[model samples]
Target: MDDAIQTEPVRQKKQKTAAGGSKAGTAERRGTDVTRVSEVSLSSKRAATAPIAVLLAAAVLLAGCWDSREVNELAVVMAAAIDQADEQNIELSVQVYNPRTAGGGGQVGQMSGGSGGGAGAFVVRSAVGSTMADAMSKLQEKLPRQIFWGHGEVFVIGEAVASKGLREHMDFLLRSPEIRDKADVFIVKGKAKPLLTLPVPLEGNTAQTMGKLADIHLGVQVSIINLTRMLAGSARGAILPLVQLSQSEEKAGDSGKIPFMTGAGVLKNDKLIGYIDVATMRGAMWVRDEIELATVTVTPTRTERGDVTVRLVRSRTKLVPRIEDGKWAITVESEAQGDILQNTTNVDFGNPLLAGRLEQDFNDQIERRMTGAIEKLQKMNADVLGFSQAFHRRYPKEWNKVKDRWDEQFPHVQATAVVKVKIERHGLSSSGAVRPNDEVQAE
Candidate 1:
């Protein structure tokens, strides 16, 4: 009985081991049965599609252009000038680039040299009409190629044209599909035709040179879109950079060229009412918060006869408007960090008390600039500073009530300015660039 029991247990153990072996063997067999598809097998399928792909490519290549236009057929326009011709007529002058020379980019792109006597980089064509479109149509009649407006880089309006009104002229530009809104706008102190005719000495094209000037941030960077938005909104007025032709020698018919960004042209009701000179334009730029680069020269007191020029690094302006007793007033706060670029006065910057005094002088200088801009705006009743826009955004209800007589009300609005300056570095040295041991004053 004991032997039979022992044998039954041995049989069960052998059966268990056999079942485990069967599972592992079945798995090995399944793995071995699997096979990979060969890459070469795709060759036949590729061969089947080869002719179809070739046929499709041939069909595409054989197709002709639906609208084929030649570059040579277009007259590339670089700049445009508008001026008054007669009481009933307006003059339009276009600077057409001579594409035959200098890779055909300019009579504007192909400048002879630094000298004046040449075909020049562009040729100006003038036409007279009652309207901008009429003038363009008449202008187009004279040219063999169509006026390609896409290449226009600058629009210069004469004092006469600007004085009359920019509304009509701006309408043409805004409605035209061919013209780009990226073009910079400028106001000439005098007639714009002569400015376009003058040969450029520095660049391949004068338009490109003016474009660089507009980007310099010394003056307003007003594009068509910028002006359009300002005019459409409740902004009091818009400002544009004023450009004047400056002769190197001031000789008659000399044409030795230089284009000067003279000042800011103040606009009221889409017409130029007056101009703010470069000195005051700095103040305007301060209020506009557009001072990318500026140098402030401050003379502290009678004892400090010389000027200390602070070259601003990073500057910011904040304008706050408040309604007090149904009256609106703006408080302008400006802050700037700068390094002493020039110190003709022997003010010891190392002395904390002296540095503090110098900083106060800077503050006063900036405050004067802000108030100066505000004063001019008030005098002209032109709100180029957009003070009304601030009031509109903050106090919408008040702006709507005064929107009709905003121009008259704009002149009376009260403004206060506060300026803070920090002179972080005194350039390479701690004191004035020209300093004497005896000339140095005590703190």
Candidate 2:
């Protein structure tokens, strides 16, 4: 009985110890639960505030371009022109797309002259002031809606305005945030306003036609950005496509008048110095490595054959500049591969020997063209052929010495053209389609 009594007390003591451990574990679990709840609450608070912070930041960023106007309140500009109004004033002309005339679908005439039969699809408007900005402000006063320049794709400069200088005009164009840098720029013959007023049968207006032509590389394509870089680069010489109205019976006031790009205008220091004809422009393009593809016609010298034309499939040009004893010289190394477009000669192009002769003739023709271009550029003392760029890239130290006097030294710099042509294809026939009487042979 004594032993049982003692063991019972011991067992009671052990149960008390076990009960204390269970209470301690419960307290630790409750503490853990509280910590988890506090962490979740903190995270939920952060998540709730995140969207507000994002919204605030978005509003701040959107404020930059938030000055938006409805389309109906905008007079969309399709093209623009700058001209010398007089010795003291300048003129700014804009062609605005008329939504009323462009909205309806119908016949060709109806499509051009929409529901109300309004004044075609576009209208030309002009304002005169002492500067481009002033003229633009005055132009805004005349328009019913706010002028929108975001859609403009073409800018034409008149001969008189270009000759005067473009620094002041360019300043405004470059400063305007609404203007696009990729817009095509052109130098038009005579008055720029008249060109804008000319009736165009296709593409809504003359501006569309001009932009399409530039995109196709019809002439020397120079965008606003390109002209800016050329003006600012080591060679302050820029080339722009020259616009000329087509000579046809259709008068300027007629509804079917057309304007086309014929040549390139050369500018030195942002001032128009001279104009390059189509042939010389091609040569300039070759020297500048801008020839995409060209169709060249030449009369074969080996035999008394007729004219043969070739369409260059691919071409590459490299300008090699060398300074020998301070004598600066640049060699134009060009290579071309082409297919015979028209073979009016009696000889078969399949013969390697005859093909060789044709190749030589083609090379000679290209060389002559490039030489003529170089001569003309030298005469003008304009470095629009990338000669300045080439020399500067090759010999930076030397370029710095003559850069100031480049105008005086450019006319004397020696330039030569070396061309190689490979006749890759002779078309389906090796001879002319119309066999000559002398080539007649009995079957």
Maximum-lDDT candidate? 2
TM of each candidate vs. truth: 0.80, 0.84
356-383, model 1: which lDDT tens digit per residue?
Answer: 8899989987898889889987988888
Instruction: Give candidate 2's whole-model lDDT.
Output: 0.85
Residue 166 in model 1: lDDT: 81
Which ranges in model 1 have alpha carbons more than 4 Å from their true place? 1-68, 103-118, 250-252
Go through the candidates in order and give the clash count of each: 7, 0
Best by TM-score: 2
Per-residue lDDT, model 1, residue 109, is: 38
Candidate 1 Cα lDDT to native = 0.81
What is the C-alpha lDDT profile of model 2 across 322-365, one tens digit per residue? 99997989899999999999977777778787888889999999
